[model samples]
Target: MKFDYQWVKDPECFEINREKAHSDHSYYASSQEMLMDESSFKHSLNGVWKFHYAKNYKETIRDFEQKDYDCKDWDNIKVPGHIQMQGYDKPMYVNQMYPWSGREGIKPGEIPEHFNPVGSYVKYFSVPEKMKDQKLYICFHGVETAFALWLNGEFVGYSEDSFTPSTFFLSPYLEEGENKLAVQVFKYSSGSWLEDQDFWRFSGIFRDVELYSIPSTHIKDLFVKTVMEEPFDEANIEIELKVKGKIEHCVIQSELLDPDGTEVLKHEFKITEKNPLLSIPVESPLLWSAEYPHLYTLILTVLHKGEVKEIIYQRVGFRKFEMKDGLMCTNGERIVFNGVNRHEFSAKSGRAITKEEILEDILIIKQNNMNAVRTSHYPNNSYFYKLCDEYGLYVIDETNLETHGTWTDFYDKDIILPDDKPEWEANLIDRANSMFQRDKNHPSVVIWSCGNESYGGKDIFMMSEFFRERDDTRLVHYEGIAWDRRYPNTSDMESQMYTPADEVEKFIQEHPEKPFILCEYAHAMGNSNGAMHKYTDLVKKYPQYQGGFIWDFADQAIYTLDRYNNEFYAYGGDFGERPSDYDFCGNGIVFADRQLTPKMQEVKYNYQSIDTTITDENITITNHYLFTNLDEFVTTIMILRNGVEIESEEMILNVMPHDSITIKNPFTPLDEQNEYCVQVVYTTMEDTLYSDSGHIVAQEEYIYPYQPVQTLSNKKIRIADDFANGVTRSTPKTVGITDKSVA
Candidate 1:
């Protein structure tokens, strides 16, 4: 059957002729160098492409996907970029408002017909000689709204769900010579209503595109789970593998290596079926935590007739996150998530973020004393989760679904999606499954958020159930139930957004059945975050009050050049587009240009794990970390007289985890009459993956009140000024100033 272009507008037609789903993601390698250097078997198709812009489907060139079409003379546009940022369409930002609000009246499953933007992209390339005879596939990391693919003038597939990776097998449609790859992206679709997030509206293939070939006997999917018993003395490592292609004489071998590169466990098995499960137990296993992120590597080898065909490497951490006694604990210690909501954004490229930018964000989070990050509203790039595992940051991975616009105007009516509607159930569930499968392997992910704010419904409740049924190792989070209390069990924790500190405390005290976490709090808008310490103080007072994530980490602004060629960071409404939220998108502690603002200081002080209190004669140090000790930090003391430094000393003290100690002052006061104060600074002892040596983590100061010195002036007058200058005779008188009167 010929490919139908109308499927792009149909809500039910999400995928067509796509490859069979196996696992989230996997790669192949023939040698160790190829495994480490991923560019060997994979080809990146992220350069320029011949592009065509059309206002609507009627104006688009109908035969642009044909092989005989000459697209060489067309304009060029960069892949992994937004069409709006490239001057094809205007960028519009809105919060809880659809882009086509007043321009057109559209239903749930219907899109606008007059002004929808469409981008046609064509790229030509020849298959590499190494992958000619193998099974080749094309992977699109992300695409907006909806897109259709064609190769060599033959229909390949269509896909939606822009956040997760969409992959298609291309070996069946390729030829010997140059092959033409064409993709048509629609800015508005039936899926657009389900994607009304509080950010700018952009459309394009805004992520990496790559072509890869897998070996005959390869691991299609891998899931690793680390189980720890009480007391955390030992752990059981479970490894599951799904093998495909060839399995007659293949043997699967798994090896576990500790953080110090020492092999701890090895198991070998014969591949009889498609799925194989294996387990290994180790005594006295080192646990993983945000404070001390110890990692172990698991390597999988697929052998055909005693020869290695492919190797899969995964980083694993041994930790346990669970709810005990109505409190969330990790490794038997109560975990306080000093977290922030992060958006995958870039100043130059809208949603197409690079590895360097991802690393910089993680480093900034770690340096600011934050230990957790919530992939705000959606799942970020897969590389981000892997980096979190290596760098030790807790992650709350969320699904890509938001329907805030549905409840904006008719809020009293409470009209929302997938509530009882059977048609929307499949698409909503598919989104949840896609996110779970992709990010389930990472140990850093402790919670699976159903989605942002799609309202409470049976569809969302089913998604939460799906997560719990598939994986019982982690918890689920959803803040939508706060708006609709019909399904109170939709989330494991009592989550809310922007709840005042007093109300949070009262709720926890009243109902302690479930732990409370302000999933979204401390809105970091412009000149905002006033009195943020109130919430942080509640964490210490009530055990049920777990820490919450700030609204965001960095501002969502795009770089633009003005008419006079002057460059500036532009926010909402800057592109002269209507239905915008103005500067509402500029609510980040870090500016769009990667610079830290003043609000970060308050965040740093409130999130620090180490607590220090100073008195007149002693300094008391307390360690609140779960798995780290005070010895890992260096403490320096500076003695000041009248705010001027007089003596400096580095103290050597060892405080265990969750312990407190008091030490006497090492130096006596230099001048008692003058004001004396002491400043204590604590910094890391050694370099870590996220911070360097001597990076200040926490500090405190103590001041002593003083009384100023009182002086009495004495005046002396010479009696014989000029006449008796030679004799030098003088008379002296003393003047006293009393507390009651001065003369």
Candidate 2:
């Protein structure tokens, strides 16, 4: 493995000497460190590094990780950043195809031989004083395509699959002080075929890198699963624990905190054997929903005899989601998801988005009446799922797999990828396992999606079955089954992309077998999303036509200086690249600058869970939420005559979910037949983790006694020969009197 790079082209050799995948759970040294809210055991390697670029493999520096190599004079590049953005290579944006389309004729599991770029990076650091004499491990959160690592002239490991965490043991290669770390990143690889998503082609290390040390007695991983029964108030919390390292007689103490920071349950476990299992019960648990997001914090304290070794914290939500009577239901009521597809992006940082930016996006999504988001095409950063769980949003977590370019040519079916090819099977299943293991504990993720747009094959079906066999708490979702019905059971529900409402209705009526949803719809490219209410309106006519996610959440635009040195947002082809799909990446309702476009107004109204209707003599308020009541919100009514406020009043109504209430309007009678308008508004009465008090939830307006005006003739004002009389007179056309303006 050290002499050659066969792992780059051989799909069967997915990873070489890499650590096994595990759950992404954080642990602290003590309860005091956990309260400080920072990791005391982890060291960050996310700063500057000496870097060198190569256009091909032949040009890369040889033996760069040798103990005597002097690399201080090399150029400095930022870690967790893409090489193209740092003035090393030109960035290329392509959709539904590989970036090397015209330059090479590539097959199923082949690589481009000529122009693939390589990046050699070197970093020098010493072990943290606290991490010495412990088991040390290095983790790379993400890297594009493929990469190899070395320390002090010894090869560590190699890995692919750019979206999940890859860790390697570093204690054996430990140097005394000022040790060298070298990483070689390849732009394209065999794994690139499975990662052909509709995004910009980028290379290098693009995510965080960390070095952490584990104590002699540590918790390796923890899985928290909640079991809810009929009536759905009580919950049975089951925990599967894995302990590692030298351990003496140990006991685990567990405690649960409610939404209001109150302890509800406590238990003690005796670790008599390996991989212990424990269960606890909570009476009348506060179930979590999008409308009322209730979360419970669980804390575990590990003690060996009389001293505390480690403490772990995790957030849990007790809600039941299932397919009940041909409709998707949460907490025993039918669910409708008002969602949008999201791509993690920024104008300045490319795919390396910041924590502040993620927080801003989540706040905007909640503010605009959206309740769900589909992590379209791939898995996002770990912080994204944590934020969703804290701020309350439903997520559809997708695996990092797509081969859309291969299937577009149906004429040559023999040339498509993963079409019963045995070599590609292991790679696909490994990608699935990596994603499921890292993200299965998130309560926001209700569905596990098999790749996207890679037409259907037996290999795709196997990926779907892997998800089903691993976890039964969540349902499976796949959209490629429409391309081939040989695997009708790939997706538990029938999902499609950009299907019309009438067609969606016809399918549900024709098949009468499964629930239906549009995985992607309402393409929101600049001033679009017209008639989007048609899809949301179908939630009433058909119980199975649940809702659809708008095409996207934000535009994928980058900032580049123009010829005049002025910065402007640039789309595809702006960098003078070949085979570009220009401006198609700007399909988000929110611009790249993090500002909302005018199209958001229509989206806000269409996706609102509450609906209000106003008339001349009556007012109607409806609660569309599946588990909330109208009494939880503050409702106010205001009336205007000719756009002037005549009367304003507050109202009280207690309408249950999926129910409506009608009351006499609080508006005065019209005396002169002026334009009378009525408005109904609903707002939150208290503050939440995501929103503030008095935030408007839903609103509607209506005008009564309105009449349509017609222009029978055109208006004319003429100034004629009066100029000769020293006093000009203007005359209005007499026939225009028939179409007089109404006051």
Candidate 1: Cα lDDT at 571: 90
Q: Please give the distance, in angstroms, between residue 91's alpha carbon in candidate 1 and its true position after superposition.
A: 1.4
Q: What are the per-residue Cα lDDT tens digits for candidate 1 across 1-743?
A: 46676777776778887664444544556545535656355789999999999988888888798998989899999998999989898899999988998898876777889999999999999998877788899988899988999998888899888888788989988999999999999898888878889888999999999998888887877778998879889988887777778899989787888999899988888888888787878788878888778898877778998988887777789999999888999988888999999989998888888999999999999999999999988889988998898889999999888888887754644357656566777787778887887888888999999888888888889888988998988999999999987888889999999999999988988988999998889999988887998999998899998899999999999999999999999999889999899999998999998899899999998898888888877888998787777888889998887666878899766888889999986656654456678888898888989878999999888877665456544544445655556543334434322223211
Candidate 1: residue 456 Cα off by (Å): 0.7
Of candidate 2, the 10-residue stretch with the lowest lDDT total is 733-742
Strongest candidate by TM-score: 2
**Cα lDDT of all candidates, in order?**
0.85, 0.85
lDDT of 2 by residue, 197-264 (tens): 87788899999999988877787777788889779778898888878964568888999999998999
Error of 1 at 191 (Å): 1.1
TM-score of 2: 0.95
The true-versus-predicted C-alpha distance at residue 207 of model 1, in Å, is 0.5
lDDT of 1: 0.85
